[model samples]
Target: MKRLLLSAALFVSITAFAQTYPKYTNEAGTPKSTSKPPAARLKSDGTEMRSETVMPSRITGDFQEIMERAVIQNKEHNYAAAISLYTQALNVANEEQAWRALVSRATTYQTMDKPNLDKAIRDLTTIIDAQNAPQKQLAYIYTCRGRILQEMGDIAGGCADALKAKELGLPVALMAGLEGCK
Candidate 1:
């Protein structure tokens, strides 16, 4: 009876050990794609295969493309290319799009090795003078123009703009730097 019990115990242990761990395989099996299927699929025999329908973009305009390319050129330090693209974008852009292009171009001008303060001021002023412009954008424009004014030795103008920006709820910590304001 003891030998019989031992044999049964050994059989149970072997069975448990065999089924304890899972089998791992290196095969990738069939590919599962989450993206919309290709518009056209070709089989090995060069025959077209049916695929899931894919939708094309509805946004058709050169303005967005020009703006995107201009931003890329600006980041790469190719100011001339960026400026040209921005100009093209402005020509094809609507009023709101034109505003964005102007602001971007003005910022790029300010960032150049030789800052174009005149053009920057003009761009900011245009935005400020636009009909129904947002107050927050106006505040930013005022602060930007004020900095340019101060740099160009117009202390009074700079101070006045700084005061305006402060009144518009923008933080103007640099007001102390405008010596002529007091």
Candidate 2:
């Protein structure tokens, strides 16, 4: 089931699209994508290599509704609205759903113009403190935060995060090794 509403994007996608999209667009939300991001990625090789946000088949109810709306707002570049909805989703979401929303929010804040580095790290760190998501999920968050820290000139913090991500099996951290991350 899909519903479409237009708005601006802040951090993440909502819950109603069937197509999978790459993670985020620029702060301006150019080169628009028409689908929500997958909570998980394709962990296989060969012809199966592609990037997209895959929604589970069973998402339904109010949590789903909020997430879907948030996606719409995010895609439409209604960032403030998207953030509010994601926050609303938090109040209703279960443990797994909360993790998803937090990831979405953290990524959003990290990427938005005049990126909120502190808020982004705060959200990512909350997830880290929980340690509830699977290792791959944690690895992804680490890389996201690491990139933010690097951008903020916290090379040590960023490198630590990148190294942690690498330790958790995401080789992308190695690729994220900015100039001083040796």
Candidate 3:
């Protein structure tokens, strides 16, 4: 009698657990629902509820076009136009595009009549601090920041960045002319 009751209890518990967590889809593997909820639907904490479905923004095409235009503007020596387009690209950019846009904007600033070294430094520092950037790209960013710092008369800071770039495997030729890196 005890064995029978224990077996029944175990079976009941397994059935209850299985019923509580149903499969998200049928055997065909298609999603159970295709409809998405309205974006304005939110919980008390200003977060999306478990039942709410959010769609990802599709803007990579627009981002690429804006970045291309920015590059063209930069090549034409239209620093203001290039900077504006780069900013727009940044708005819709993913991780890779954001880094590229920031670097391009920093380079554009360097060519301006009155270079905004501070802004360039901020942008570069953002990338560095994110820590998810590729090593080669980080090396280039550090080198660029180092050059800007040198231009701004921050010799020690420039040297530090230069050394960092070198440590990250920047070509020896590129570091050859950077003072204090040797």
Candidate 4:
């Protein structure tokens, strides 16, 4: 009957919607997380507790903590915080991580202030010239450089770099921004 089909369809839709968000798990193979940040943990006494396994506040040696902060700030469009965190991260970032962070932070800079062409160019240039960098990353470097140049009034150079990036296997998303740069 029509009612039976409608009920089944409603159940399927509800199931799909409920499954959209994944369950969180702890590093020690435990479940039942409350979807809060790792800093909020429960103790045996039913009070809030802070554990090394639950909270990674000790990730201070290298740029991991700073990079995580930068990534989160970038997602939230907090450009100043992202810039500061990325700067701290770059101080300890290895060659590989620095290159990626440069690109990411440069993007945030561009989004924050279109007039910050110099900062964007500097970041992209650093990435493009990284020694022994991965070829795929090189493609991304070219794309970022292309955007910087285009924004800085170097139309021809930007288009050239954009074309080279696509030829070097940058994704369509990167190339899509390159459109009209010519």
Q: Once model 3 is optimally superposed onto the true structure by TM-score, how far is the C-alpha of residue 35 displaced, in angstroms? A: 29
Per-candidate local distance difference test: 0.58, 0.59, 0.62, 0.57
Stretches of candidate 4 above 4 Å error?
1-60, 113-115, 171-173, 180-182
What would the per-residue lDDT of candidate 4 be over residues 1-182, giving only the tens digit for each residue?
53344234323432433353222112222222211113444788999865212333322334556777787987787888897777666554544455545655666666674346666776676666654346666765676577557656687887898787778876665454454754
Models ranked on lDDT: 3, 2, 1, 4
Instruction: Give the candidate number with the greatest lDDT.
Output: 3
lDDT score at residue 15, model 3, on the 0-100 scale: 41
**TM-score for each of the candidates:** 0.59, 0.63, 0.64, 0.59
Candidate 2 regions off by >4 Å?
Answer: 1-61, 173-177
Q: Which ten residues in a row have the lowest lDDT in candidate 3?
A: 22-31
RMSD to truth, every model: 29.7, 16.1, 24.9, 17.9
Tell me the tens digit of each residue's lDDT in model 3 across 85-179. Answer: 87766656654446666766776776677777776777777678765456876876787677667667787888898889889987755543345
Q: What does the lDDT come to for candidate 4?
A: 0.57
Return whichever of 2 and 4 wins on lDDT: 2
List, residue by residue over 1-182, the lDDT tens digit for candidate 2.
00011111112222221133232212322222223323333455634433222333333346667888897988887777887777666555655556667777776675465566676777777778777566776776776677667767797988898788778986552333333665
